[model samples]
Target: MPASPSPLSSPPPSPITPNLGLVCITVGPEVRFRTITRTRYLSFPEEERAGVLHALYGDNIGRLAGAAAYCVAQGIRLYRMSAALFPMLDLEGDPTGQRVLESLSAELRAAGDAFTAAGIRVLVHPDQFIVLNSENPDVVRRAVYALSFYGLIMDMLGFSRSPWNTILLHGGKGGRAGELAAIIPTLPDAVRSRLCLENDERAFGPTELLPVCREVGVPLIFDAHHHVVREKLSSQDDPSVRHFVLAARATWTPPQWQVVHLSSGIDGPQDRRHTDLITAFPAAYHDVPWIEVEAKGKELALSDLKQRLKPTP
Candidate 1:
């Protein structure tokens, strides 16, 4: 019989099995190399407003490109774009504002191309100012406007109505799920297409938000950490956690992997805050393909989690 091959001659045992699939680690728009500007129309001199706005757009586009490059280097496939991308967008009626929008649109197209080339998934979570179920009509109007603006940005990025490039939002105000369901039909086609609902830590948990999400025909974004903080629900052992995970998974149609958010609670009597690193993995969420790490440490936390999954020699 031929002598057994020496350990050095043996092929490096197939590299550790890759994780279920590509995980989306958030590299949000915060590259330290370039500075981003938040220019408002009234903040600059009347004669210089247009120039100032144009410069801001240039800075943002540069920063976005840098962020994308960073993601590619770090193996991060999912990123959340900044909500303050174009701060004074409401002034688009004026010639200067219109020019800024037009230029930004072109710049975004190029950035989108780079992201698509690298297979990056882009997401946008508008700020809390967006409350679809607010009792005030003005508030609702502003919320709708914000969604439309974000939708426009998505379109410019060449991201069609797909879960891969999603717009996440919390199910607004407790007890208003039905109202939210009702208003879904009234939203513009652009806003409704890319919208995704997420259960909140305090108000709407799966029990309250699932019905609304189903009614509106949008996928749900399950945040495991939020569930644990608010309801003591554990994705590892809680039956309801598994049940809701499947429920949320079902809402996603083909070509869209279920996206879950993972984070660890800070140590405290009633800890709900996200810590820098995840202390435990959601065993039930192992099957989910795309998990967005929301810890304060961001990409560094993801690296730690990946190490945990590596097999011991």
Candidate 2:
């Protein structure tokens, strides 16, 4: 029998402070309401229903930009826009995609400008599918090119795309660290600098992913929810979690900003789902500069965070 690797063998410690933040994802079509609905669901107050409605859909620039604006207005300095922008092109197909991309480019430019003017940082969150397995190389190329346009237009770097099932260690036909090392070097310096790697929710954690980042010289982004879920499943102790956070910090140089994924999870016997926004905030409130809450009622969920960060007498 072979000896199982001790989890402690992962990484050492470092100093970093976690800040408050949220992630924005468009939910549905905007609905107009003349009055407030006094129906309470979950922890959100009914009086704030209108705000919730607006955050989810009202004033949206399609889906991606709207979500970005909603989060920024709520004092969330960091926002993650979905990769749906690219797929929207592919789904619509052809010159339709060309038109859609043009329109999206304009929208992203405007949104990026608004965020920049307001001193907020916006990052385009790319899914692994577009980056790793698009059948058409042009699709992948265009996606990256389009994002680079948005990044340049907005003056922000986008999140890096790693294998989706990385949390599971499945390694299903996607680029691993060494593979990514080769591909990343091929991108233009501007594009490469904007790319950031994130820890997956299923298999890998900062401990597992940071070495890849260290080798490739790309910065790391941590999803605290992912780390917690991994811990609960493995029943690891606090020292282990602390060790991973430290290791992740080691991958970054000074004055480097890191984005963290924060969201509450529902612990069932079988698996954890990012249901609420309660658990993640407290655990990560002191570790990083930006935190993106990936919750169902993100805006309302953020209200909780605002209350927490308020100055006390």
Q: Which candidate number maximizes TM-score?
A: 1
Q: Model-by-model lDDT, in order?
A: 0.70, 0.48
Poorly placed runs, candidate 2 (over 4 Å): 1-19, 26-72, 86-96, 103-108, 131-175, 231-237, 268-270, 280-285, 309-312
Separately for all candidates shown, the number of backbone clashes (residues 3 or more apart, or on different chains) is 0, 11
TM-score of each: 0.84, 0.63
Off by over 4 Å in 1: 1-41, 91-98, 233-236, 268-270
RMSD of each: 8.0, 11.9
RMSD (Cα, Å) of candidate 2? 11.9
- Give the alpha carbon lDDT tens digit for every residue of 1-313 in model 2: 1122122121223254334555445333321112222232223654653344333322334444554456555666665554433322333222333443444455545655665555565565654544532446776576556545434433322222321101111111234445545566566555566666776655456665676678767667666556667666543224555566566666656524655566655553124565543433333235556656666655555565556544443
Tens-digit lDDT string for candidate 1 (1-313): 1122112112123333322222232435446322234443566688887777778777777777777887788777777777777666644345575567687787878888888899878888888768999888888887887688788878887887776788888987777788889887788777788788898788789888888878878889887667766786533346666777888988888524678886666672136776666666655665666777766666666676666655557
